[model samples]
Target: SERIFENEKVTVDTIPLSHRVYTNGFLFREKPKELGLNVDAVKKYGIDISHYHNIKKGKDVLLDDGSLIPNSELTFPPQKVKSYAFCSDTAYEPGIIPFVSDADVMYHDATFLENEKHLAEKTGHSTAIEAAKIAKEAQVGQLILGHFSTRYTNTDQFLEEALTEFQNTSLARDGKVFEW
Candidate 1:
């Protein structure tokens, strides 16, 4: 695994994937955000905009009169950190479980149906059930199946196969936006 990107907002990591050619799957984890401002509390305390940054950073607010307001009274707690994993064009590899574990959302290669295991193996792709097994083992919140081959038309079987293992599975479509 490798840390490919990092910043205040999010961090990105890459995990090696099992494929005919060398491939890397990406994991994205959003950093804990600054606490949200309590507008009512700010107004009650008569705090100015200049203090917003520090308050959101969880620092106590000190009034001009010398009284200090606790950070809890000044802002709301930060929301849960969200994580996303994208694993594509790879065979079912257990090594990726840790990197994708507990991710809020995961988009993985589900290139073939269960009946096409041979084709999937030859192509270094995963069947719907295989993808779901990985997601279930990793305990991901949601699974998105994509990178489909042209040979398949009806996707109901794919979803059906995957749903057997992971209930929170969805088929990826063009322009579909999924957020945690």
Candidate 2:
């Protein structure tokens, strides 16, 4: 299940990939589209306003000096748009794979270790191994494991377990910053 909120500024979506009662995840995405111009190249080629749109569209521009400027020289490539999936408090449900496939980053619940998978299932949560399996199946660029159960004191084991399936797996901690 999913709910989408949209307006002029942004669109937020709540995805229900969890089996626990009253649990959901969120996906935040940007909506603006802007073409960046290489000011130095534009000045060097003497490109005028008439060619701005074409340049933004990745087209070569004809300069007033009767020279041609390749789009690469006149404009910076569009910034890569990124997407993130937050899958906390969810069980090992493959149904969410399609929704988060190819996401740049995925934060999934790794509330227990493989040894305690029974407890994880009982609580509608996932184990570190299960989180890694989902990340691998989704083909996400990075997998972040969060919502750890307090039963385990050394969280490195969680990372170790998840890494066995997905090398890109990491354990989320406070003040941790992930960059694309």
Stretches of candidate 2 exceeding 4 Å from the true structure: 1-3, 6-10, 31-33, 49-73
lDDT of each: 0.93, 0.84
Question: For all the candidates, what are their Cα RMSDs to the real structure?
Answer: 1.7, 3.1
Relative to the unseen true structure, what is the C-alpha lDDT of residue 110 in candidate 1, on a scale of 0 to 100?
A: 94
| Candidate 1 local lDDT, 47-163, one digit each (tens) | 999999999988998899999999999888899899999999999898999999999999999999988899999989999999999999999999999998888888777899999
TM-score of each: 0.91, 0.81
What is the Cα-based TM-score of model 2?
Answer: 0.81
How well is each residue in 41-127 modelled by candidate 2, as lDDT tens digits?
A: 787766777778878877887656677777877777667667788988998989888878887899999999999999988999999
